[model samples]
Target chain A: MSYVVGVDAGGTSTRALAVAPDGVVLGTGRSGGANPNSNPPEKAAGHVETAIREALGALEPASANACVIGMAGTAKLTDPQVAALFSAVWERLGLTGVRIVTDPEVAFASATPAPDGTVLVAGTGSIAARIRGRRMVSTAGGYGWLLGDEGSAFWLGREAVRRALDELSGTGRLGELTRSVLAAADVDAADRSLAWRRLITVVNGEAPVRLARFAPLVSAAEDAAPILDRAARLLAELAFAARDPGESTPLVLVGSVLAGPVGARVREKLDGLDVRSSTDGVLGAVRLAGIEAFGEDFATVPGDLPRVP
Target chain B: MSYVVGVDAGGTSTRALAVAPDGVVLGTGRSGGANPNSNPPEKAAGHVETAIREALGALEPASANACVIGMAGTAKLTDPQVAALFSAVWERLGLTGVRIVTDPEVAFASATPAPDGTVLVAGTGSIAARIRGRRMVSTAGGYGWLLGDEGSAFWLGREAVRRALDELSGTGRLGELTRSVLAAADVDAADRSLAWRRLITVVNGEAPVRLARFAPLVSAAEDAAPILDRAARLLAELAFAARDPGESTPLVLVGSVLAGPVGARVREKLDGLDVRSSTDGVLGAVRLAGIEAFGEDFATVPGDLPRVP
Candidate 1:
């Protein structure tokens, strides 16, 4: 009857699942936005707690021995203030063995048990990480949307909007996809030129982060077309950067960016690279916590983990 | 004596020079800040008009045929209302046959009269213009510092601040120049990290446009060693973009950006390119207006252009 809980607190949604020692997802639950930057640390932890409670509630009289949460803004959590706030929340939730780490770590763990691979993550934000001999190295993810965060879903979304505006203003040569995308964004020839500046300002200021949530839609929009070509190119860059020199280590593709058309485009752009979808962040977190709590024995797990929910 | 006037109205100073038909030295006048964006159109124009009158007053009583103003924000005069307001100021000054155009055009015109040439202007802001036939095509200059004016003095200044903040936060890898520059800005190691975010917010919110005026100082400071190497690559990019293929024509460097070390770096970056110094905008404007007014015949004039007062 021993059980465990795992949480993936993403920018737009929080997901939790109850799991048995054998890796079976006993029950699952979801909640609204849970990013620490958007929601306070206490609120973010509460969201994870609520999600876990709901998932465990689905399992009648269910119980969990330990819990681990893979969070998008773990950098913020490293701050003592945020950690203190979350610590209180964890204690209040009656959760005993809980560990929180970056979502990318979970993604890497879920993708494979080996600690020598690379993870290319492009959800709302993008970051590339590689693990070599127990050392974790990362490139470009300073503070998310505001500063650097290049090659992320937000970056692609922002670039798409910028290119669209350039096309509308005749400042940039329009590709087939860009023209239609601008049209879809409600910008036309007559009004496009007149409303160009204002619309561009508004789109550049707001739409990037929001449109990132629709990474799947953008991917779908690009299918059989050339809309997200630039995004695909960026994804290729991230993948190339993640590749190990002269080594055939797995290149794991994680997040919604790899869920649909964008992923297909990324694969096409990647050409001969081998990449696969992440199993699930929560599952990865569970495995990671297990490894930390139980050492090498955690690698002896017998069953396959569940796919991302 | 028939005299033509060229006025360069900047954010900090309003300069006016009266030139004779034979390009002889006449008289010059200066006034305070006359940027229309900062001061009311009439007030800004009044400052320039007063300066022009005073400069002309120093000359013997003679009728001037035409006057040309190479102004920074003329394109912003797109609004009929604003244009009309400025037009009245021009009429009241009894300045007839006046032509107003973007300041960069004047710099390009003054820099070279070779029907096809390019101008890379990096003053308070940055703009690259390619003049071919009768058309002038520009890259990246929407509206001063408010909108998009990348690769300009303001951009560099702002980047310097951001890099300093990044260095303090242990997130950036800036060289010797960054630390010195931040120290000069009164931001040091102890208060550097804490002051960074607030300073950036202040710079982003209010100081960008003003700090842009000090780009020359920043370039000068960087040029004296330590910082020159830091921005050499970026300056090279700007030079290359300005002298891209299909732009084999004569190239000119204009604005305060060309005054100090940045200019030297620019020249080094543009090594073999034909780059010349243009200290006077009014002369450039008048030279351009002369060409436009008289076409091919204008180039035949022998070393008779008016001196920049």
Candidate 2:
């Protein structure tokens, strides 16, 4: 009857899973965002606690032998005050010896049984993590939208706008990508000069990360092949940087940007390597919790839990 | 008694010059920043008026045949209210028929008498403008810090930080550029892992454009040659984009970034073209005003005015 609990605390939402010793998913729970950097510390901790409580609905909390929480802003917990908030959550849930790890580590675990590998996540932002023994040892390009995050959705969207502006500045006929970019920014194109200025104003008017909204347009526009190719190359370089020379371990690609054409290109660029895509990070957390409770071999156990849709 | 007035209304400060029809320096004035985009409309207008009034000295404002104001944010005057603010300044000074032009136009005029050419300005932000008949007809890469501004001081500084983070993530020796960047961020590199995280934190905590503070380090560090070379290439391309194919007009380079190593590299790249440096935009304003009042021949008038120190 013993079980383990796993949680994926992300910027937008939190998900938790309870798995029996034999690998059956006993329960699942969901809650609001729990990333402390984006949410109030107390609220973020409360969300984690709420999700964990729901996942343990009918099960006895004390019977859960191991618990693992994978978090997006794991560095935020380095602050004593923030750490104390999360610790209080664990205490309220009557849980002791709970482990906390970076979201990328759990994502890598979700993709492969390998204990060491590289995980590259390219959502609104991008980062590549070097995982050792199922934990993140180091990371590359997590500098966010302002500094780095090259090859990310933000990068792709920004490139799209830049290309559009270049076309606007020229006398040539506008291409599909440029046309779509202007349309998305709600700019009227009858006046090319005014449109150029308007597009910049519209993009800068919103939060910078919102530029990711235009990423899908780049994938759909055939003329944006260079952008796609460059994105793939930058992403591959990021993944390669997180790995050692000649060390071949599974590379797990996660997040929305990697789930499309960019991901296919990244796979082609990362050819000859064991590349896997992680769809459900909470499942990775479940696997890590299983490993902690039932030993390393538990990672290989088959489970009927489907990927989160 | 007839004289012409010229003003450079910039983001940091305003300068005005009253030049006699004979090209003699009659009077000069300086005041606070007058860029409407960065300063209150009333304040910006008041500064421009103050500078122009001082430059007039004991001369009758009605005797001023022509006045030209080169402004950093000329687009701001597109709004009727903002335009009225500037109009009131001209009206109060009895300055009839004053012309307002973009700062790049004046920069080009300051460097050469050419009516059509390219002007590249790369200070905290970067932009290249196509000058036609002593006016800015088109522009490129003026999307500001968020969307573009490639090869700007902000870009160089951001690239320096990115390189430092990349070296910190790898197992390689830290380069001089990396060391300088880390030091600039006030991050102690005793622990590479912690330093990597701290550098990102420090950068994200401040205004993004503040990254320009590290730009000088890029010029000083020999290891940052690639950054310098890329910056030069980007800036040169920007200038080229603002020109017609095989057009041989003067290309004027202006701003603080162009006054250093990056500027030297840019000049080298723009070889075979008439590349000139613009030190005092107010002088250019004076040249334009002279042209407007005393016919184009006045642009060739010999005078004892020295470049602003």
Residue pairs clashing, model 2: none
Best by TM-score: 2
Which stretches in model 2 have alpha-carbon errors above 4 Å? A302-304, A307-309, B302-304, B307-309
lDDT of each: 0.63, 0.90
Worst 10 residues of 1 chain B by lDDT: B139-148
Q: Which consecutive 10 residues in model 2 chain A have the weakest lDDT in total?
A: A300-309
Judged by DockQ cut-offs, the docking class of candidate 2 is high
Q: Candidate 1, residues A1-309: lDDT per residue as tens digits?
A: 766777888877888877776667778888876778778777786787778778777453324566778887665776888888878766766667687767777787776777776777777776676655323564423334543455567765655555555555455556554555555556664555555555554464553367454334455454324546666676667656555565567677886667766677887766565566787676676676556544656644512765545
lDDT, candidate 2, A1-309, per-residue tens: 799998999988999998988888788888999999899989999999999999999898889989999998878888999999998888889888899988898889888888999999998899998999998888878889999888999999999999998899888999999999998888998898999999988998899999999999999998999999999999999888889998799999999999989999999998999999985778888889999999988888623466543
**DockQ winner among the candidates?**
2
